[model samples]
Target: MADEKGRYSNAFTATLAGIADLFRKQKNAVVLSDDDVITGKNILITGASSGLGFEAAVQLARRGAHVYMACRSGIPEKGEKVMQHTGNRNVVMLPVDLSDIESIKKLVGQLKEAAVKIDVLIENAAVVPSGSRKTKQGIEEMFMVNYLSKFLLTRWLLDNNLFNTDGGSIPRIIFVSSESHRNPKAFDWDGFGKYKEYSMGKTVELYGYYKLLMTTYANELARRLNPTSQHRYSIFALCPGPVNSNIARESPAIFKPLLKIVFGIFFRSPKVAVQPVVYFAASSDVKDKTIDYLFLMSRKEMDAKATDVENGKKVWRLSEELLNQHGVVFQKSFPPRI
Candidate 1:
């Protein structure tokens, strides 16, 4: 059985390898200009206190975007370092915890009251809990923080017209997903709430499912919003490749040495990983009605079934149902075809 499983995994990974190869060959073939700096654009990036998110935020701010750094805790020293290094005066740090729906709502409400028109929202906050745990809302900690919070926040932003600029340019939503969604293992939606018995592989699989959901929801929301409005909006899912970041620290201590060694050898730096996100957030090449599932460093499109409209709609409905059960209304009306 172990041999058979290994064979199947190998075959599955091979398929993904082919797709990634195609993306790598095609990423730089397309020319993009840096003239489209997000000058005076209001942007919000979650998890900006550290890692890839911090790098992306700093880059955006340096390009003249007004960035709101939404983090779970007060400004960390690392964030100060980023600001100092970038010298971007437009950065505003805001406290937010994605696990709490009320906190998310309050933050959006504050933005609305302030009449802030957000041109770009990078849903980058995530949590890989050390052990099995539940969030304040009783959902699995990883799922709640990684997927649910982002879904709810995107919905709130769209429904409240936060993405609508005064000049009528539609905003963009960029979800920082992973390449692991290409795994062949089926998703365990029902089992997401029960995490105690999960092994490392299972945890990684769950993270893949989260990425699948991100791609699904991004495309679905794009399709839903594009046809109805004249102002253009786009959604993108970006995989930052394997990066040397603090995420590995969340693993069991026994594996820390191995993880560090492996990451140090194979992982890209956070600055390198954040380039694709910066491109998606500010590039004119990714215009209205485009849905891109990109690889890091270059704007390479990845293989994703969630890019399909039907699959995206299905995931969107299920996500809405889940959010509604948690007393967070996703507020967007789905078309009859969905």
Candidate 2:
């Protein structure tokens, strides 16, 4: 199989691709109305310290949602900023290092201990590292942060009954995936969950693969959670397109100035790029759907590979097995086979 599929093989290519996408008319764009209110809804957002995640927290807070900022850094200060900007004091900061398994478990444990019943769980935490680095658990840092952490965190939440599913509104699980998810033609099944050294040259390629893993997992989670079209929970994944954010903070110094110019000139700001996420969190249009995806503000289908039943099942199984290998056990009976 090709190392990667489609156009986005590296940062330069990916940036160009995103820019090209912006020019295309969003024919299926769904407007987010000011009337869609999420007042008092307990929404948990990961990576809310900066960039798109931070903007999302602010916007959601402005809509009156009880925003929980789950992040690795920027504690009281970030939370305070959300309150300062939105005049909403329901925002709370919850620290979590997404690259570490123990830290994720600690975060979930803290939420459960506090009896926090989350209505909207936004899995927005992600990283684009300079090169391949190992987490404390000896897994690749990017893989752990960008994909596996979401799987582990969401599973623990469901297993512990942390989601407020009994409420009048169905709980929503939103993933900040990417259009790059379509760039990986296939999965690296043999190399799954194994750490191998690589440099920036291979970073974007692997990034797309991990995204495919995440998108696949999202589909499978929807299948398992809302079987027979019951639509118990709304599972959403979206590509916010390219946002001018700190996600590329680790780029080589020589290219930083150039990237800054290109991103500033072409990329959308975090505030503008976060509309789809806000729509998913607060909009009633998608409240009853089992699964949904968006590219920019327009509704779109996920890649065929991501939507494949066999691929989703295999990815789900492998992810569970990998976690088990790392000593993170699932206590409850998971979904029966599809």
Candidate 3:
């Protein structure tokens, strides 16, 4: 019903929905204090080269966290900019193409070689392609970058024990998901990971579907990692609302000018839209919670499909199967509760 009212299946409708959502009065809104900080903690964030991810790096670095910018481009430049803006030399850049499995594996190996134990990992990288395309591994580009890569990367990190899960503090895993995840009616189980051709018209719809897969995985990750009464990790996800960013760079040229105008006038700037992300990363209010979701600084529940126990298990199983079919194997065992 909500999706039927304001489906984010198109750029125009999505923009309108975003603007309307922001103006609604927020209840139980959160406030981040100066005392809330992540000083000396190692934080790895993907897609840190631009948009919400870039601003998040700057703000988190400013809060005294050692920020690792995992990106496909902007290798040294973005890292340099974050350091210059935040005056925190702990910022470092690591390169990885989310569409390629080898690249994801290489990223995991690099962190292992460096002995970098992540205190917080923000899975922020995503793409809105002009059409269907294949990656180096021959999988659908959007499917890999938007959803499967996160599943693979998180598993690799956890299997290798890259998260700093010591008794000192809870390790946080944050997913930069979208409210558009609710647009999809249900899972396309028959075509789960199979590559298919699509045009720009289908991109936005698929984006929401991938976000659904991701949000479900986030729920599943929390369940698998912290099976006992004692919470071993903190898994969080949120929709930062409409960020005026380059995510729509793939849109047709005819609409670019108008889209830019609307985005500039209505959408929240990356600096302002990134508050919820910063809150999840640094605020003390969420550190103790096993899981939480936020939309524009207001707490909310994820879609029912994403939170369903059966759906979470099925997503986890199907994801593992898909990766195995692609010859990417998990080197270590998971927490064995399940």
Q: Give the Cα lDDT of each candidate.
A: 0.72, 0.91, 0.91
Assess every candidate by TM-score: 0.85, 0.97, 0.97
The local lDDT score (0 to 100) that residue 21 gets in candidate 2 is 88
Write candidate 1's Cα lDDT for 45-147 as tens digits.
9998878888888888888898888987657665676678878777777788888888898999989888888888999988765555766777777877888
Instruction: Write model 2 residue lDDT over 1-338, tens digit each, in one string.
Output: 24335668888889888999899888788989999988999999999999999999999999999999998899899999999999999988988999998998898999999899999999998998899998889999999999999999999998899999785558999999999999986788998899999999899988888888999999998888877756688899999999999989999999999999998999999999999999999998997798999999999988999999899988888899999999989986457445
Query: Candidate 1: how large is its RMSD?
Result: 4.3
How would you encode candidate 3's per-residue C-alpha lDDT over 123-196 as one tens digit per residue?
A: 99999999999999899999999999999999999888899977767899999999999889889988999999
Clashes of 1: 0
Stretches of candidate 2 exceeding 4 Å from the true structure: 1-4
Every model's Cα RMSD, please? 4.3, 1.8, 1.4
**Which pairs of residues have clashing backbones in candidate 2?**
none
Per-residue error (Å), model 1, residue 192: 7.0
**C-alpha lDDT of candidate 2 relative to the true structure:** 0.91
- Cα-lDDT of candidate 1: 0.72
